[model samples]
Target: MKKSILAIAVIVTLAFTSCTDDNNPSTPKSTFELKIDDLKGDITDGTVTLDPSQTYTLTGALIVKSGATLTIPAGTTIKTSTTALNTSLYIGVERGATININGEANNPVVMTSGQAAPKESDWGGLVICGDAKVNTGDNGTSEVGGLSFGGNNNADSSGKINFLRIEYTGAKFSSDKEFNGVSFFGVGSGTEVSNIYAFESGDDGIEFFGGAVNASNLVIVNAYDDSLDFADGYQGTITNVYISGVSKAGIEGSNNQGNDIATPMTDAKLINVSIVKGADAKFTAGEQAINFKEGGGKQTYTNLFVSGIDTFAKLDTGSGATARIDAGDFKVNGKNFVSTSNLTTDYVSTETGAGNGATLPTWATKISKNN
Candidate 1:
């Protein structure tokens, strides 16, 4: 009864709230009386399912608090405000909350900016926090929205995420702090993610801040920052990742930001990963395909291929990080991306190579921007 009441209350609020914003005439009040922009605040109970037929314009934050679920069905399109530096508009699932995005490969859920000509940093992206182990703390506060996450539940499930495409995300807060196409903070193994495509992100395409969520079939294109990043004691198995046109390291595998010897450690595995750097790709020193730094922890790479990048891997020689390397805890099985790719080595195997080099992988053809 409480769940039904809560769901009905949300629908009522959306139907009644007058969205006439005198300051910004472009407010969603002009379109429909059931202003989708007014759908903010905490969903403390019940499951709120998004309608695939009706369009959604997110003007503010939509938070799914604990014990709540937000469902987005197949072909659901959600557009956000295009105002520059607007980081407040996003979909965040707090600890104990669930987000079930039911999207098919051909008819996937799409989220982008509502501007006339959308570009990067148009709005924020999906941020999911869970009660998983993190080296940061018991409950670490996230970079965006300052939401609390992390706990002792390694099997905690936030929900399912698959066949979702996020474009032009990564709103900046500071030089070092910014949003990504998807930020998984302390997410656990019970929550599965697959077929996530991130395009033209202003920051990292996808970043895992201390989680044990095993994901696969991830594709990133034209990311302004690192294509993939994992840190803060993240222990997950990421497979079948295809990355290209990245500005920084294709994979920034770090343990922690400031503290090198944080508890737990960012120990993860990569299987059948491909990072292809374009000819025009530019990167700083030590920013290559795989960069192990900040006290990098244990990692096992299998069938990890790199092409068009001169350097394959670089390790931070910092005292803390060097010690970890010297102790045989971290090693880079990197080899040049050349004709001898299929030699069947421990690392740098191009057998599958995800897809055609420097292009979208075959598994991501159904939901790709190029298509």
Candidate 2:
């Protein structure tokens, strides 16, 4: 008779499992344990470096406290649990707090939602907080200093994150607010974020609270919400972004509902960005490719290619919302915006206010890659 199939309950403290070539039944299973206290001094208030050879799983919240830096080496896979029973990894840097996470292109660091195949809901997202400033409107959330951090000051870089891939993130918060694949809250201008990719995020791929941190080489796919949402006066430039949303048919497979705000802001200077709209059929009238609310900062576009938009670009809710069209672009605020460069628009809305019909700047004609 075949040996009885038994369900063994083995408790591994480190919350990770590895494969080996040994076949001895008598050999004890290798186990790794890392308590919060074990990483207390190393990560809480000091520099913590994760070993490239070791696979570490977070059992509770990983807090990168104020005045500390946590560095994660490349080719590291950081996994989290799904159920609420285990605390999620929270990297909230308080006032004057700092974190430096640097990864490479070929060997990028991955922060995922859960270890399992990723069910309906998995885990929380990455939050980078800095000592920058924000303007959260009259609701009084703006007065808080640490509310919006990341900025564009290269000299005083506060938080640094690069070449990071975040997958299956954007946890829900009371149905109204949800976690972003990457959340930059009050991040200062000195914060450096680049070469980041977000896949299958339940919320916004990347949300900026306030600051001037320049980001480039961003890729968002199958995100439930907007690709990039900037609020509270973000004054940095974003380049080379490729955002593609899931089609309407795939909406049923989505983990979260639809996003109230989907389109990117009209403030930051975005060049060479491609936004793929909803593939599903649940789009409301307000869903647009680029929605510039009233009161938003001045914005301009160049070498932009748009497909699948109810409206290409429009100013809706904010004040001072203006999007200057260039020759190298397409529709904006009901005008046929175009660029003299080789750039072209495959589709232009016949709606009167579909495009603003403006000329693109000369600098936009150059297609040189950014540093």
Candidate 3:
């Protein structure tokens, strides 16, 4: 036989090319090289879910592994860490961790900072560590300075985040301690963050500490700080927010220990919100708009549409700081709260506070066009 049929046809053509390279689905068995200073430590035990129409392109810093479940499917483009001290993505989620970034709103799923034009310290965003349960000071000091970060044990829907779009993040190391494009420390409230967008941030583009979560449609633009910040005792339910504070100012709801030092107890509930201060230019100290602080407890404002310059709203050095305002056909607040929060809305007052250029109080324009 001709060398036994050429050694059985070269072992059946090497077993049909090894079963066609094991049924190639673009075959990539192992080539792991996740770098960016190896992404700190234990980002939720390494969970990577994605794959919902599959498209992942992370260059570095891709840590999400606690109880492992990082599913980001909705146009995914997670690229960061071009080394500004290893930029962005430091999501340290532990205690049975989980991260399910279900993006939408025209396929929104991007946690960027691998800079081309990125600014705001250029990196670090989206840190959610929720065990869910607060008020730790009674023998259960619960590691704040030591920094384990994450609540006691509560909010459980098995951890889910919704319709996201985190852009141009805040990535500083000092001075108001940057890095907040969506950082919900101690995130409880049955963990399911909502329609989020923190664009062009430098800091405070969305922060809720001491969790009891209930967020809704937040959109902050050009932030430097305070585009919606809540501190210790963050008993939450922040609704329909739309902030356009350009150099910072437009909701600095605080209990402030800087943000965490057991800074809870601000019990929040703001609805149909709209804060516009220095919309894009003008800053002296950024200007204030609805700043309530320490000695905390109590916040309930309905239908607000601020147009700012300076002090459109104020409450910064706390003591019996309780809020309950329902300025319905909104325009800052009756008689135009000191000429519509005076930094500049073309001042000297003519008063038209909502919209039609300003004047939409038909149930606050049907609750701002049904949110």
Candidate 4:
């Protein structure tokens, strides 16, 4: 007689099973339990907390499926190893899932490469997907993980990220499909993100895709692309940002390109920011301090201080962008050090913002942990 498959469930210590998320009840994913020294896989249920004393290495993709939470204690370090072409080696939280990175000011959580000579694009980076609204198609899919994101819940909570530093991230899988140092896909304002640092990313330091999450105290260093980017009808409020050594624009804001008249256009409001044009001339065409294109929506920058290079604002030659700007929908408001000229009338000479001029902000002082 053949043994029944149900009989093996009671005797198995580590059982492999399929799980369905509440967000998308039809989609199924393989689930597994994470063990020390090997912290990667689909967490399907409950909350798993990492021991700060033990060492953890991410060898593959760690997906926190819906209805699960992954908690990293303060002073925890998660070293990662990845193949040159495999961008799937990342930590991602799906819709209805949560990841709590609890790092302190002095003892922060570090996520970096484990190679002897680590370089840029060594591995993929952190990705959080929530059910927040987006102007994309019915659902937006991520390039790195192929996960479906976007919904109508603007108050959805993905979780909290605090005092964490991620280094050597932003792996590229294709010409257009690449990873940001930190990517928030349709995340909501209920999530708490603060004191995060991005160092030496191959793409943008941090990116938000049609989310309402409010992020604060962010620092990006040596970003290969734009330091900060938001598109697809994102309505988020970011505060206290410091960027340096960027090969592209300091900030890039846009909306839905396919459907420029989509509901709830992108609204970007930032305060106390400093963007310094670095010496990385590898991309000479990347000479825009702030670039608004593709149906650019309302953007307000307050107490902004920019040093090195000129070109305060540059608008792309998109039909939707031009129409939006002409209609005052892409109006720039706020007091800043540089004069945007025709872009904004609210310009003032600002010596420094975010409590420090072009230097690293005090809130992002935990960047030392990743180095």
Each model's lDDT: 0.79, 0.51, 0.56, 0.79
Q: Write the per-residue lDDT of candidate 1 for residues 69-104, one digit (tens) a residue.
A: 888998998898655346887889999999999889
RMSD of every candidate to native, in Å, equals 9.7, 15.7, 18.0, 7.9
Q: Residue 257, candidate 2: how far off, in angstroms?
A: 22
Q: Pick the candidate with the highest TM-score.
A: 4
| TM-score quality measure for candidate 2 | 0.66
Encode model 3's per-residue lDDT on 232-321: one tens digit a residue: 667877766776644656676655454322344556777667666643454323546665555345566556666655445454432334
Per-residue lDDT of candidate 4, residues 254-369 (tens digit): 88778766767898888888877766676432647788867777677777777664656777677777776666655443322222564331232254766587777666676553
Model 1: weakest 10-residue lDDT segment is 25-34
The candidate with the higher lDDT, 2 or 3, is 3
**Sliding window of 10 residues with minimal summed lDDT for model 4:** 342-351
Tell me the tens digit of each residue's lDDT in model 2 across 260-354.
12222224666566555645664332345565443444454445555565445443332232232322222333334433132223442222111
For model 1, the superposed segments whose C-alpha errors exceed 4 Å read 1-39, 83-85, 279-286, 331-351
Order candidates by TM-score, high to low: 4, 1, 2, 3
Evaluated against the true structure, the overall lDDT of model 3 is 0.56
